[model samples]
Target: MRNVILCVMGVALLSGCSWAKNVQSSKNRVYFENLYFPARLSTNSDDKQSFTVSVDRIDQGLAPAREAGRYEATKYCVATYGNSDVAWVAGPDAPDSELRIVEGRLQFEGRCDV
Candidate 1:
């Protein structure tokens, strides 16, 4: 009985984090909703456009979250610079955004190439 209850709780937790899955075109509308989901862009002292996107809970892992972050950063850069070109700068792992869970938070980093 205890094992069954634990399994149920685990499934419930995973279901609640369905947002962590890759944002498909059918769910593009959802991405828009996450626009201001602790995501922001800032110009560094060197004039580099830095960006960061974070999600509280990640289900599938960091790859999907990183992809979503990159997408959001690109959108932001396009809106701010009339172009969507961007270059990843740094992340919790490496410059290429490796899988690393930090305090139950998933984050991605990049820089706009405006």
Candidate 2:
């Protein structure tokens, strides 16, 4: 019946919303929220050319999330040093977390090739 279909759809939608809420609360939302999406960059020394990038979750997909960290690092390198060349000294992959979700944090460290 039409009513039955409508009720089922409503329940599905509500459940989806609930799952999202649970996921949000289950992870380090507060920690991630404080950081910039894709990546957060900071210099490691007073030279101002050597930098590091700390990356948070990418909701699109896990693979993209991993690559986003690299992309972000490269972007930062180019912006700061006029070249996209960069070498990551740490963390292009997501480490294990309590939630076990498809989200993660990534980090990279290196100097601009300039």
Candidate 3:
């Protein structure tokens, strides 16, 4: 009798999962490599304080979103999104790749030391 009760309870629980369509998804993903230079950000009258950033080399970048945990330009294209900051940066002249995200868009000025 206990086993029968457990099986019915399990079926109820499994069927209830079908009603979970309202939940937001959490699997959004992006990747970048073979970087494009000078994202060529247009000027916004400087009154807005639009900043600039750099990426030094291909292998020096550290974008964790890539499928292999590295930017693969041919397969991935790194993008910047969210609050503007000096992010995804490496050192200059040392396997360095700098990236910045601002206002939900990415900027790639150029190779930092390449």
Model 2: per-residue lDDT, tens digit, 30-112?
22233435556788668676777666655545455456566666777777678887654554553535212333555566666
Q: Per-model C-alpha lDDT, please?
A: 0.61, 0.62, 0.34
Of candidates 2 and 1, the better by lDDT: 2
- Candidate 2: TM-score? 0.48
TM-score of 3: 0.22
lDDT at position 55, candidate 3: 30
Model 1, 17-53: lDDT tens per residue?
Answer: 7745644534544342344223334455676577665
Per-residue accuracy of model 3 over 2-96 as CA lDDT, tens digit each: 99999999999887775453332322223245443222222235422232332333343444222122222211222322222322332112232
Worst 10 residues of 2 by lDDT: 28-37
The TM-score values for the models, in the order shown, are: 0.49, 0.48, 0.22
**Model 2 clash tally?**
0
How much is the lDDT of residue 45 in candidate 3?
53
